[model samples]
Target chain A: MIEIKGLSKKYGSTQALSDVDLQLRPGEIVGLFGPNGAGKTTLIKSIFGYIPYSGSITLDGEPVTRKNITRLSFATCEHSFFPNIDAKAHAQFYKDHFESFDEKRFNVLMEFFSLPKDKAIKHLSTGQQNQFEVIMALCQGADYILMDEPFAGNDIFNREDFYKVLLGMLGPDECVLLSTHLIEEVSGLINRAVLIDKGRIIGDVQLSELEESGRDLMDYIKKSFSYRSDRVFEALDQLVPEEERHEEMA
Target chain B: MKKWLSVLELHAAMRFKRVLLVLGTMIVLQMLSFWILGDQSNTQTFFQVLGKIKYGWIFALGFLAMYWALSWPLGRNETYSYTLQRLSVTERGSVWMKFIFNALCFVPLVIVQAGLILLMAKIFEAGKPFAGNAHGILIDLEKDGMLHALVSFSNPAQVIYRIVYILIATACATHMEVLFARKQTPILSFIPPVILLLINNIWYDEFHVAFAAAIIISVICMITALVRCRGKKPLRDILEQQEV
Candidate 1:
């Protein structure tokens, strides 16, 4: 379980996240859907204490700090593995460093993904690297797992296999927060959806509610951004000649 | 204990090739110098050779320290990928543990070098059948007062001083490497260490004073790194507060 409140982040004059709030419960799979630069990565990084931000975040009612972070696991599309280390060695390093690392589970995931154990992480295809990252995170056996764009470079089959492996690996006490642009592929897998645009939480609803509303997740996301586009167009129209606006409309 | 050792092992693995290249280069250069000189005997020649070796060691250590300083920001950024966002207090122990681990790795290397020097002295004495006073080299070292001054500096005091100084340098280097490894402004992390190193060298004539000053400065740096690393707070809180 995690609780985040009034979280805001700024890089120089540009805002990356703005007053967003959310709560997650155990055993829940939440999909964070957003377009490029939608603050999805920022939110995920913030949860891992990788970036500094304003406000409060707590896991199971305990304040987050560098000490207890070992209890959580995070994965991102960005290359984090040591470039020179092969996949097997990287996994071994993780197992040695993290007490909760499940070596058996990691090996199984590697087998499932058909990742080359002897290949240096830097040499792996992007999809294989992502798979390796996913396997590493899952093996940590943390109560909370945060993934940022984990399926960025995968083919459709690899993506499907990843989802299947992820679903099968989830325990009753674990929760996973996956941020991605590919909402359609994971729509059915997620129980809750948090849609963000321009650094704000525009929609946070149950997946069931979204389906019941009969709007596709991708369409809902487009509509959320379209509202801003519409506002901008309206402002532009007000500056245009009346005859020109009418002609354009016709 | 295990986790800290694992961290050290990982650090070594990551920097293994670089360390090997540096040490290998130094050893080869030293061997070449010895080969060209034909043979080294007597206190005068021995001091010259030892002086060169000492300078070589210092240069290598300084290079390592600078490299570590330069890489701090990137290493820190890379480490964040594996770190949990929530700020907790456990990093204090982790930092100290890493400091110890790095010092332990370097200890054997230093001892082996010292042992080789002593063995070289014995071998030189064995080859000269005409030379009656073989122990003169050791006596001369004791008289020139560098070795005596070093050994009798404060009995066990010098060892402690050396250990602490080495630990601080290694710790700071390792921390910097982890902190600055992949950041847009990773060079920012090097500012403090470089500034301190420069300050220590400002009064070049005061070499002894500067060496002591450098040790103190490194200690302060280690403390600063521990504070910054331990106080890391999660980014999620920042995201939630954005006005978007």
Candidate 2:
């Protein structure tokens, strides 16, 4: 389990994360949903200790450090693999640095994605690179896998296949804290939805609970965020002339 | 120890090919230098020729090119550093490993210089045996001045000072490149070497003072780099905003 408490981060005068608290447990696929600049990336980076924040983050029982960091893995759209090195070399690197690196899983994912093992990762297409990034995170054998928009450039079909692969590959002890804007697409895949707005968590809901209440994930998110459904129409009303509006109504 | 070796091996593997390429190129350049000297109508002893020839620039350029190449993995566009930081058991170890690797890369250049000098000396002695001198080919240390002072190995103080200065300069420069990659302002990286050179130029008579200053500044730079790296404060403002 990863526990974060009173996490706050500031970029100069602007607050990136404000007293944010969240916990991730085993066997749960949680979707971290937020609009742009809502501190989703900040939260993830803080968890990884990539950036500093004023809070306490503990993995299992101890603080996250080199000794215990192997338990957590991350995949970002920006990519963390050595660009000049091939995927096979990356596997060797992971195997060297991480004791729990799953070489078999790495091979399987490489074959599944049809990524060239010999070619440098930088030479791969954008979508293929994204797949490789996610593959590495999955193969790290980490208990908690944090993916920040790992499917950014991938096609819908590829993402669908990956979601399926992820489902089939994940063990009961593994947890995935996924941050993405594809809410409706991931609705069926994730067990829980964590919503953040303006650097604070607005809602955290279990899919089962939403289903019991006869509500879908999107609708529940809309309610929790107090989303203005008529804002688009209101903006259009201001854009159009009164005569044009009347003509359209007629 | 095993893990440290593994890390070292990984670093070396990533750079071994490029280092060899650079090393091979430098060797060719060294041979070319010798060839050019051999063609000259007015032949001189090894020390005199070495002091006169402008081949030192090749070594300087080689080291500079290598420094740039080594900085590639840590550049903003690359991600090897993220893996490296996470994998390293201690940031200090990473610093030391990089320092050692970079220092070792310069060793071949010195070796090439030594070998070239001996080869040039033998060729000079064998080709022209017209001398009433007892040593056959007279070694005029004073004739070659500064270059001789640097690589002659005749003056123990000068040799020791130069080695210490080069090692420290390498450490500072390598550490500075790392700090720069992490988005930190690293102007201090060039200060030690530049200051040492200026001191050497201005205070040639007070060599001991310049040597002591080199030791002090190198220690300070090493400490600063180690502490800052261990802190790992990559700028938060420049953090990649990947999420929507």
Candidate 3:
């Protein structure tokens, strides 16, 4: 479980995240949805304590810090493994470094995936590298896992396989916080969704509640943004009469 | 501690190519010096050869130092997304592991080079067919004092001093490299070590002070590097008022 309060991050002239609050419960799989530059990654990083931000982040009620990061595992789309080493060596290194690493589980995952153990990580395809990182992350046996666009480079089969393995590996006590733009693919996988735009949380709704609203995940997302955008247009229209607005448009 | 050590070992193994390249370059330079100076028995030639070899060692040290410094920071791009993902699972020991990994890489290389030199001297002395002052080449082995100096690891005091000195130096070098890489001004990373070397040269007669000063500077640099990395701020934060 994770709690973020009044989280704000600024990048010089641009605000990446502003006054955002979020909470993730154990055994919950939440998908973070946002367009490019929507501060989705910023929010995730801030929660992970990767960057210095004006916010309070607590993991399972404990304040997040460098000392306690071993309790969390993060996987991103990029090749996070040491590119020069083989998969087995990389896994062994992680097993040695992380207190909670589950070597048997990792071996099982690797075996199931049929990931080449001897090939250098650099030689692996982008999708394979992503899989390897995911496998390593899961092996940490941490209670919380954060994934950023884990499906980015994967083929359809690999992506589906990843999701299956990921879900299969999750115990009842584990929670997953995933951020990705592939809303449809992840819609069925996540129990909750957080939509962010322009450094603010635009919507936070349970997937079931969102579904009960009688709209598909994509439709609901589009409608939410459209409704917000329409309010801005309506406010602008109110500043001037419809005739004036029509004349200006003409 | 064992876990951290294992990680360090894996890191060194992953960086095998870079380490091999540095050691290979040093050996080549050593061989080239032997070739150019050509088997002369004159005292001047011996001194000249020794001088070049010493300088060669210094040059190799500099190269290795630079390589060690840049290895982690510049080896990969520091994207916010990537940093966030990595931080999720990373431990503080991960940072310390980098320093230990770099140190472990040089251990075997340095030992093998030193051992081979001593072994070759013994072999030549046993087969005294060519009598052209082979004793001069083997002088370091004959004089226990020089041998002790040459094998710095064998002297407890020297070992402690070198360990502390190299640890600090490497740590600082690594820090400067990260700082420089973040700013995309890697060129400036060389300044700290260069300045330290200059100070060492100026106070060469006071070897104790020079060594201490180098170690102190390296420790300071390492501390600064750790401080800078304490957050997820883009390494470029040091170079400019840029945001990520």
Candidate 4:
């Protein structure tokens, strides 16, 4: 289990994360949903020890040091790959550094994505690069996989297929904490949703609970965020003149 | 140990092309210098040819290539510093491995320069009375200030001083590379090595004091650099928050 407690991060004057607490267990896929600047990326980076934080994060009761860091893998839209290296070379690198690297899964994903294995990552299309990023994170064979908008550049069809591929390839011991804005897209894939706003987690809910209550995932989010359904109409009414609105209605 | 080798291999492979380019250009320029400055006269000395070669420019180009290679992990597209920092290796070990790998990158430069010197020595052997031999050629070339610390292998004390000097220079450059990776411009980091080199040149006769000072300064610079590599609270963190 990966546990985070009282996590807080301050970027100079801005609080990127504040008193955030979360836990991730094996065999579960959780979606971390947040608005822009809501601290989703900051939270993930903090867990990976990419940045220093004020709170404690541990894996299996030990601090996330180099000894057990291989248990975690990350994929980001900003890309953490060597641009000069090709896909095959990346597989070789992962194999060298990560003892649990799954080369078979890497090859399978390369073929599935139709990514050119020989081309350097920088030469690949943006969508292909995104795919390769996620592929590396998955094939690292880590127990906890953290992805931040890994499919940002990928098309909808590609993302849908990838989500299915992810579900099929994950073993019972694997856990995924995926942060993306496409909440509805991953609604079917993730079992739990972790929602954050203003640098604080506002809601954590299980999909099974929402299903039992006959609540749509979107409706649940709307209620959690106090979605103003008529605010759009009110803003439009204010923008348009009364005479113009009446003429359009007529 | 195997992981360190993998890291070294990755760095070497990534840098192979650019190193080749710089070395190729350097050799061609040296050859061109020999051709332009060569005289068939029996009086030709290795110094005559080396004197005409733009040694300063070559050194700058070679060292600049090394600096560029050392900065690879901090590239803009993806900061592999994060990758390396999270590795199972100790922070100090990783920094040392990277520093050693960069030092190795300079081997080709030395080989090329040494080869040129040997070739010149062979070509100008007929003028031995004037050119003196390969050892004499090195002794002759050591007259220059910067090369003074590096080439006096004949003297045991000089050998030790040279090692310390080289370590200081390499460590300073590595420190600068790390700072640059963090997007911090450290113009001051280049000062210590330059001052040491000047001490070597200006106080060549008073070897004991200069050597002691060099050893102390090199050790200090190395410790400072290793401590900065810890990445938790780098000395430069005051400049700005480290994004890595």
**DockQ agreement of candidate 4 with the native complex:** 0.30
Q: lDDT for each of the candidates?
A: 0.64, 0.75, 0.65, 0.75
Q: How does residue B188 of candidate 3 score in lDDT?
A: 39
Root-mean-square deviation of Cα positions for candidate 2 versus the true structure, in angstroms: 3.7
Order of candidate numbers by DockQ, starting with the best: 2, 4, 3, 1
Model 3 chain A poorest 10 in a row by lDDT: A76-85
Q: Model 3: clashing residue pairs?
A: B182-B235
- What's the alpha carbon RMSD for model 4? 3.9
By DockQ, the better pick of 2 and 3 is 2
Off by over 4 Å in 2: A237-250, B33-39, B42-52, B72-74, B117-159, B195-211, B231-244
Compared with the true structure, what per-residue lDDT tens digits does model 2 show for residues B1-244? 7777776666666666677777778768867776775443475455555544545656555555565555444334665555665774566787777777767765564566556655665666666555312263334434443345445577787677667766876677667756765666666655665555544334445556656766777777777777766543443324643332
lDDT by residue (tens digit), candidate 1, B190-215: 44344434433343234455556556
Q: Candidate 3's error at B10, in angstroms?
A: 3.8
Across A154-197, the per-residue lDDT of candidate 2 in tens digits comes to 99999999999999999999999999999999998999999999
* Candidate numbers, best lDDT first, in rank order: 2, 4, 3, 1
What is the per-residue lDDT of model 3 for residues B1-244, given as tens digits with 9 covering 90 to 100? Answer: 5755675575567666777776676666555555464243442323334444453344446445546633544235333224222443343345567666666654554454556445444443444334324656555433333234345565698567545644655665566545554544444335545544543333333456655666666667666666656554443363124333
What DockQ values do the models have? Answer: 0.24, 0.37, 0.26, 0.30
lDDT of 2 at B119: 61
